[model samples]
Target: MNTTTTEAVPLWRRAAAELLGAGLLVTVVVGSGIAASRLSPGDVGLQLLENSIATALGLTVLILIFQPVSGAHLNPVVTLADRALGARHGGGEIAVYAGAQIVGGIGGALLANLMFAVPAALSVTDRAAPGQVLGEVVATAGLILTIFALARTGRAALVAPAVGAYIGAAYWFTSSTSFANPAVTIGRIFTDTFAGIAPTSALWFLAAQVVGAVVGVGLVFLLFPNRKAQP
Candidate 1:
């Protein structure tokens, strides 16, 4: 258990580790979300709540599993932002991690879609209404900011429970009740089912999520005031 944060681990190995970690997380998030969506056919609120709860549990497990290997940064914005903020993970490694996460996420979504037999319409169309965009932004920003703070505080292990718990609660607290990762967002499109976002509107959500991630980084700087690099 050489968990020293400064030394660079093997790029290929880290990439592979993160890919599997993120892929498993996305699978459970989308798959269990499908089950929740089917449970509450008409009640959008209930359905969203179920999706969030399942996602939180899934994320918790992923963090516990992958924290040692790749920091479990399943989101591109998070990987890049952490690097920029003087974290130990390198830029080249971040790119590989992000790429792997995207691939794994897409694969997970496809599997979930086929497993649940989701409708094509749900996969191709934008599910995020314009009215919900603000929540999407604030919620995502809050998540990223929290992540930075946790990392700086040397509480990376808490990320899993925190994200999972927050996502589960976010469904009830926020208007959008959406998962904010771009890879996960796009991956959901393949499922074309309960957790799916339309391909057409995916870019806008992606942009919003990135914006939120930026805001989160800024917030972390203001709140945590990192004097030097963290791991």
Candidate 2:
């Protein structure tokens, strides 16, 4: 009998990957939003198109870059789901990953704001409307579903592009422009740009994301209960 076991990567390295990857992800998101807003000042649709393209491309590149080291789980819910789905890492790792992501997101927002020559400011744009909240739940659920379903079906290689593409589409389809990430949500509050979300509305967005995560997990189990863990 022959068996192969994967060596555990050092915790510090994984944490670093999480932090850097998450930060860069936010940078792409917020930076593109700012650029789009300015570059197409009067045309909302054109701004959205530009932002979505940049985000999709950036996310794909980021995931491809970091997936080997950290599994490229940039989102907290993705980390949680990996643990729940029997990833070798533990709860402690999850906490660290989430913390790193949150910190990175904030740092990324600040960096983007600085790059744009905009003062680092808190968002005043309120997005707590009912339609936006509902859109968040749907967007997050679809995102989670996209990730795990691919994992379950042995299509891990496709995750980067698929997830990126899904998000790009969700930006257009969802009322809230698919702010499906908690860390990203928190980070966006620091920017007063097009990508920013008001601090007052952050809690509701967070709640909706959590609800979406739960729904996504439930769907995964229902659809792939017997699936084996993938690399």
Q: Pick the candidate with the highest lDDT.
A: 2
Clash count in backbone of candidate 2: 0
lDDT of each: 0.73, 0.86
Tens digits of per-residue lDDT for model 1 on 63-131?
777777777777777787777677676667767878998888888877776778864444764656775
Worst 10 residues of 1 by lDDT: 1-10
- Please estimate how well model 2 matches the true structure, expressed as its whole-model Cα lDDT: 0.86
lDDT tens readout by residue for model 2, 43-80:
99999999999999999999888887788888898877
- Looking at model 2, residue 208 earns an lDDT score of 94
The candidate 2 region of ten consecutive residues with least summed lDDT is: 1-10
Off by over 4 Å in 1: 1-8, 88-90, 119-122, 227-231
- Which residue pairs overlap in candidate 1's backbone? 56-164, 125-198
